[model samples]
Target: MSDVVLGVDIGTSSSKGVLVDPAGKVLASETREHHVDRPHPGWVEMDGGIWWEEFAAISRALVHDGDNVTAVGVSGMGPCVLLTDDGGEPLRPAILYGVDTRATAEIAELTRRFGGDEAILDRCGSALSTQAVGPKLAWVDGHEPDAMAKARRLFMPSSWLVYRLTGSYVLDHHSASQCTPLYDTDARQWYEPWAGDIAPHLDLPPLVWPTDIAGNVTAEAADETGLPEGIPVIAGTIDAWSEAVSVDAQNPGDLMLMYGTTMFLVHTVEQRVSTANLWGTNGAFEGTRSLAGGMATSGGITGWLKELFGSADYPELLLEAGQSGPGAQGLLMLPYFAGERTPIADPDARGVVAGLTLSHGRGDIYRAALEATALGVRHNIESMEAAGGSIERIVAVGGGTQGDLWTQIVSDITGREQLVPSKTIGASYGAAYLAGRAADASCAADAPTGSSVPYAASGPGVDIATWNPPSHTVTPNPGLRQDYDELYDLYRQLYPNTQAVQHTLARRQHRLSNATDTRSTA
Candidate 1:
C-alpha cells in the first residue's frame, strides 16, 4: 500500500478532508457541508457533534481502501471557546471564530479589570477583543454558568478535534496566544496569574508547537477513520496558519489572504509588532510571529447579496459583474453586513449602499458588492504594512479566488500582485504537508538509533503548481484609485458616525421580529 497522509480542516460552514502522498500531491478529497445556527442575532453556534460526524465521514471516504496512512494533522476556524465536559463531550455548541461578537461586554470588562489595552497587548500581543477566547470564556462563565461548571476543558476548534481523536487536550502556541489574559506569549506557557480570578478553577490546556505529536489515535478513532490504531496525531493549528503553511508562507512578508465565508488576512512578522488596530500573535511556525486582520463579511456578504438580488450562482454572478466597469458605475457599497473587524473593531457596524441611482442595474450593484469587499481587503493590507508587517507577496486561497474579477479587483485595489495556488485546497493541503513531515520523521527515527536515517522529506516550499501570478496584473488606475481613496475615507467614517443609531435600530428590529413570531405561533 502507498503511504498516505490525511489532513482535516474544520471550517465555519463545513469540514473538509484530504488524502495526500509525501510529495504534497493530493490523492483524493471530500467535503461535508453543515449550517451555522444563529440563535440570537449576534450569537453563532454549531454542534460539535456534527463536526465530528462530518470528520469521520470524510476520513472514511479518503482512507476507504486502507492505504498506508502514517500520520494526521488537523486545522480549523480559530480562537474558539469550546466547552466540553470531563468525559470530553461538548456541553453546548462551540462558539465560532472572532467574527462572532456576542462577547462585547466581556471584552470591555477585561479591559477595565486589566490595566488597559496596552497591558493586555504587552502580555498577549493582542488587545482585548470579542475575538479572543479569554473574553468568550468569561461570557460563558457569567451567562452560562451551568455549561461553565460542567466544562472540564476548553479547546479551540482544532484542539477539540485532536482531543476527540487522541484523548489529549492541547493547543498550538499560535492559537493559544489568542487566549489573552490567560496565556503568556513570552513564556510560551499558560499564565495562571489571572486564570483564577478570570475564571475560577478553570484548567487551561498545555500549549505545544503545531507540529508536536499530541498522542496516537485511539482504537475507536482508528476504526472510524479507517486508519491503523496508534498512528501519531499531531497538534494542529487555526485554519489561517495552516493556509499559510500550505502556500510556503513561512518567512516574514509572505501573506496568506483567505476568502472563505469571510475574508482572513495573516502575515508573518519577525518581531512582535503592536498595532491598536490589527491583531498580532506568535506564528504557527516555531519562533516566529504574525500580524492578523480580518473582515466580518467577504464571501458571506456576496452570498447574501446573491440571494437578495435573486441572482444566479457565484460563477454566473461573476460573469454579470464583469459587464460593469470600474467604480461600479456610481454605486458604492460597504461590505459590513455582519460587522467590521481589523481596522475598526465595531460589532455594531452595518452594511451601506450609497450612490445608487435609477441608471444603475443589477450588474452595477453586483460590481459594487465585489468592489466593496476588495476595498476592505485593501484597507487591511495597508493597516498591516503600516504596523511594521511587510507584504512582498500574497497567496490567495478559497472559493472566492475562482472569481477572476474579484482577484483582479483585490490586486488593483491593493496595488500588490496576488498569487493563487494551483491547488485551491489551502488548509487541507497544509494539514497533509504537516502529516507527511511527521511520516518522514517517523521513518527516520525507526531506521536506527544514534545513526543517521535516510528518508525523503516533504516538499520544501509551496508547490508552484498551486501558485502563479495572474496572466494580467490589475495595475491600479490613477483616476480610479483617487476616487476610491476618497470614497474609502467616507466608508471608514460611516461606522463611528452611525454606530449608535445602528445599534438602537438593530435592537428595536430584533424585538419587533421576536414579537411577530411569538404572535404568529400563539
Candidate 2:
C-alpha cells in the first residue's frame, strides 16, 4: 500500500485529477470534459454544481485502484465569481474570468468611484477590469438583484472545492489578490471599506496561502469521493499559478506561458510591482509576487477553426499549418475572437483576418491563427518587461504545448527559448505536490504549538526540479526573425486601423440582440 496524494483541477473545458506518490511519480490520472455556457455574448458561465460533480467523478475514478490517498489538493480556473448562499449553495451559474466581459459598465463605475485607474492599481495591485471579481460582483448586484439578494459568500473554483472538502470558507492569498479593489496588496488582507462598498452583503472568506492546510475532509466528503476520512486538503490557488508550480517556474525572472482556451502569462517578481497593462498580485507561496497577463483567446481560436473546418483533427491542421510557413502565406489574424484582455483590455475588440485570398486554404488560416497568438505573446512579453518584470526564463505549459508547431511559432515570433517540462499534466500535478508538502511531518512540526502550519516549510519545498524538469527547449530560427518583425509591425497596425469599425459592429450586434429579445417577449 503506497501512500498517494490526489490533486484535482477545475478547468475551463474540463476537470482533471491526478494521483501522485510522495516521490512525484504519477500513479493515475483522469479528466472530464465540459464546456462553459454563453447564453449571451461576453457572458461565460458554468453551473457551480458541475464543478463538484466532476470532481467527485474524477476522484472516484482515480481512487478506484485503492492507492492509499494521504492528502487532497485542488486548483481551478479563476478569479471567477461564484456567488453562493450562506449555506454554500450557489445562487447562480459562476461568472468566469476575463473572457466574460459582461461587467464593462461595472468596471467603469468602480474605477470612477475609486478615484480612477491609477489609484486602484496603486491600492489593489490591479485596475478595475474583466479580471477583477469586484466588478462582476457589482454587475450581479446591479443586473440580478434576486440572485444578489441570496448571495452571501464568494467562491472561485479553487475555493469552492476547499469549502466542499473541508467545510472551511477560505480563499488563497493569490486568488484573493485578484479580487481587485477588495484586496489590498500592501496590507495583504481584504480591504474592508472597498469590499463593503462592492459586495456589501457577502462575507469574504478568510485568507490563507495556497499551500496552507484548509482543513481535513469530513466523513460526508469521503463517502461521496471514495476517499478516507480526515485526509488533509490544501488551500489551492488558481490553475495558472499551479501550472507555474508544476513547471518549477515560481522563482523570480521565470515567466510561465499557459496556452489554453485563453493564453495566460505569469511573470514572478521579487517585489510588488504594478502595471496598468498587466495584473500584479501575490504569488501562490508567501513572500512572492507576480505580474500576469492573459489574452482573451488563443487555443480557442484554433478550436473554432477546427469546428469550422469540420471533422479535421489537430494533427491534420498542424501538418497543414507547418507547410504554410513563417508568414502564414501572407495572412495576419488578431487573436481577439473573444475580445482582447491584457495590454489592450478592449472588450469591444473583435477578431480580424487580413490578407485573405481565394488561394488560401484551411492550413494557411490555421497557421495564421498560431502566428497571431505568438505575436500576442510577444506583445505581452514586451509589456511585462516594460513593467519592471525580468523574464530570464520562459516555461510553457497547458494543452497547446502538446504540439510542436505552436511552440516553435511562438519561439520564433518572440525570439526567445521556451522550456517545455516533462509532466505537463499541469495544475492537478501542482496541487498534488502542494498537498504532499502539507502532509509532510516536518512542515507540521515547525509551526508554533497552536498556530496554523504553513503548507510549506521555510526552505526549498516540493522539489519541482526533480518532479518535473524541462524535456526540451524550443529555439527560434534566426532566418525567420526579419520576416516576423515585418509581419509583427503589420499585426500591430491592423488593430488601430480597424478599431472604429469593430466598435460600431459590436454595438450593432448588441442592438440586434436586444431587438430580437424584445420581439420574442412581444
Candidate 3:
C-alpha cells in the first residue's frame, strides 16, 4: 500500500482537500465551494458547521482503495472569532478576518484601554485593528451578551477542526499571535492578564507550533472520514501561512504573495518586526517571525466587474484587458470596494474610478481593475520593506496565479521577479506536506535504531523544495518602470485627497443600511 497523507483547508470561499503520496505527488484532490454571509454592511461570516461537513465530504472523496492514509493536516481562513460553548458548539457564525469591519468601535475602545497605539504596538506587535481577534470578542461581549455569556471557549476554523478530529483544543502559535492584546509575540505565549480583562469568562486553548502533532484521529472521526484510527493530526495554522509553507517561502528574505479574493503578502523575517502599516506575527514554523500585509479586495473586484459586465468567462476579459495596455487606457481604480486593510486599515475607504470617461469600455475598466490590484501589491511590498522586511524572493501562489496577465502586471508594477511554483493548489497541499512530515516522524520514532526501512534510513522529513519547485519566473518590463512610477504616485495621493468625502459617504451608507434593517425587522 502506498503511504499517503490527507490535507484539508477551509477557505473564505471554499474548502479544499488533497491526498499526496510520500514523493509529493497529488493522487487525488477535491474542493467544495461556499459563500460567506454578509449580514450587515461590514459584517462577513460563515457557519462553523460547514467546515467539518466539507472536510468529511472532501476526505471521503479523496481517499480510495489501495491508498493508505497515514496522517492528517488542516488549515483555514483566520484569525476568525468562533466562540463556542464548553461542548464545542458554536455560539454564532464565525466572524471573518480583517475584511469584517463590524468591530471598529470595539477596536477604538480597546486601543484606548490598552494605553494608546504606541503602547499596544510595543507590547502586542500590532495595534487594535479589525484584524485582531480581541476586538471582535469585545464586539460580541458588548452587542450580544447572551451569546457571550454562553461562550466558554474560543476556536478558529483550524483549531476547531483539530478539536473535532482529535478531541484536542489547541491553537497554533502563528494563529494565536494574530489574537493581538491576548498573545504576546515577545513571550510567545498568551497574555493572561489582558485575556482575563477582555474574555474573562472564556477558556483559551493550549498553544502549539503549526507542525506539532495535536493528537491522533479518534475512532469516531475515522469512521466518518473512512480513515484508520490513531493517525497523527497536526495542529495547522491560517491558510496564508500554509500557502507560504506550500511554496517554501518561510525562510528569511522570502515573501509569499497570495493572489486570491484578497491580495495577501507574507514576508518571512528572522526576528520580530513591527510597523504601524503592517502586521508582525510569529512565523508558521517555530523560531521564526514574519511581517505580513493584506488588501481588502483583489480578485474580488475583478469578479465584481465580470458580473457587472455580464461576461461568460474570465479568459475573454483577460484578452481584452491585455489589449487595453499598461496605462489601462487612462483609467485608475482604488480597488477599495470592500474597504482597505493593510497600510491604510481604513474601513471607510471607498472604491474610486478616477479616470473613467464615456469612451471607456468594459475592457478598459477590467484592465484598470487588474492594474489597481497590482498597484496595491506594490504599495504593500513597499510598506513591508519600510517595516524592515527583506524580500529577496517573491513566491506567487493561489488560484489567481493561474493566469499570466495578473502575475505579469504585478511583476511590472512592483518591479520584482515572481517565482510561480509547480503546484499552485495553495494551502491544502501545504497541509498535506505537514501531515507527511508528522507521519514520517511517527514512523521514525517507532522504527528500530539503524533500521533499513526507507522512512528511517532516508530521514523522516519533507522538503518543500522537493514538493513544489519554481516552474517559471515573471520578470518586470524595464521600459514601463517610469510610467508606472508616476501612476503609483497618483494612486497614493488619490486616497488622502478624497478621504473626507469617502468618510462622509460611508456614514450615510451606514445610516441607510440601518434604516433598511429596521424596516425589515419591523
- Residue 159, model 3, lDDT: 90
How well is each residue in 264-347 modelled by candidate 3, as lDDT tens digits? 999999788999778899988878889999998898888888888884479999999999999899999998888899989999
Per-model CA lDDT versus the true structure? 0.78, 0.90, 0.89
Question: Who wins the TM-score comparison?
Answer: 2
* Model 1 error, position 171 (Å): 1.1
Estimate the TM-score of every prediction: 0.92, 0.97, 0.97
lDDT of 1 by residue, 1-522 (tens): 888888999988778999887666788999998888877666778888877788889998889665888888899988787788777878888898767888898899888898889998888788887677888888889988998888878877788878878888888888988888788888888878767777775677877778777777889888776777888777889998888787666578888888888899989877888887888888876788899998887888777778887747777777778888878887778787777788788776778788888988878888898888888988898888888887887888887877578888887677677777666687877777776666674443123211211122334422433332233333455556767677677767766677787778767766876887688889
Checking candidate 3 for backbone clashes, the offending pairs are none
Show pairs that collide, candidate 2. Answer: none
Q: Best to worst by TM-score, what's the order?
A: 2, 3, 1
The local lDDT score (0 to 100) that residue 325 gets in candidate 2 is 86
Q: What would you estimate as the lDDT of candidate 3? A: 0.89
Report lDDT (Cα) of residue 140, candidate 2.
95
Clashes of 3: 0
lDDT of 2 by residue, 1-522 (tens): 877889999999999999998778998899999999987778899999999999999999989655888788899999999999999989999999999999999999999999999999999998988999999999999999999988999999998988888799999999999999899998999999999998788989988889877888889999998888877888899999999998999999999999888899999998988988899999998889999999999989999999999999999999999999889899999988888899999998999999999999999999999999999999999999998988999999999999799999999999999999998888999999888777666565233211344534443335778788689999999999999999999999999999999888888977887787788889
